[model samples]
Target: MLMPHPKDMRTLLSRYATARLAHAERQTLKSATQLDDVSYTLCVATATTEINDALAAADRILAQPPPAASSRP
Candidate 1:
């Protein structure tokens, strides 16, 4: 399986975490009756797709060779 670079993985994870926090906050702000029942479902679907894409990209990166080191002394 392909692996993501460390930096890329961190960034992708951060974005997903931020989005998750935002969704939670929004849910907390609304009263039970005021919240849309489908909002959580939609958010989960969107975030799942984005996270999966990131994972796939990371995997692709893993399949590539590492960069060559410089020969300069």
Candidate 2:
């Protein structure tokens, strides 16, 4: 399985957080739509079917240390 880069995952997480809060506060169709979009993107990126599972997966990924830098002569 392929993994997303930490930076990309972070961006996705940010989008999810924003969308989640926006929908929670306003409860408008627009906010709901945005939340759905972000939720799907988050699921796809994390390779999980459920939002809760995807969130846990994301947390696991974020908790990991970044890859060591490569040195080339």
| Candidate maximizing TM-score | 2
lDDT of 1 by residue, 1-73 (tens): 3333444444554555555666667756443323332333333433433545544555555566654555222
Query: What local distance difference test score does each model get?
Result: 0.46, 0.88
The whole-model C-alpha lDDT of candidate 2 against the native structure comes to 0.88
Which candidate ranks first by lDDT, i.e. highest?
A: 2
Q: 18 in model 2: Cα distance from truth in Å?
A: 0.7
Clash counts for the predictions, in order: 0, 0
TM-score of every candidate: 0.37, 0.87
Cα-based lDDT at residue 58, candidate 2: 92
Please give the range of 10 consecutive residues that has the lowest summed lDDT in model 2: 64-73
Stretches of model 2 off by over 4 angstroms after superposition: 69-73
Residue-wise lDDT of candidate 2 within 1-73, one digit each (tens)?
Answer: 6777778889999999999899989999999999999889889989999999989999998998886666211
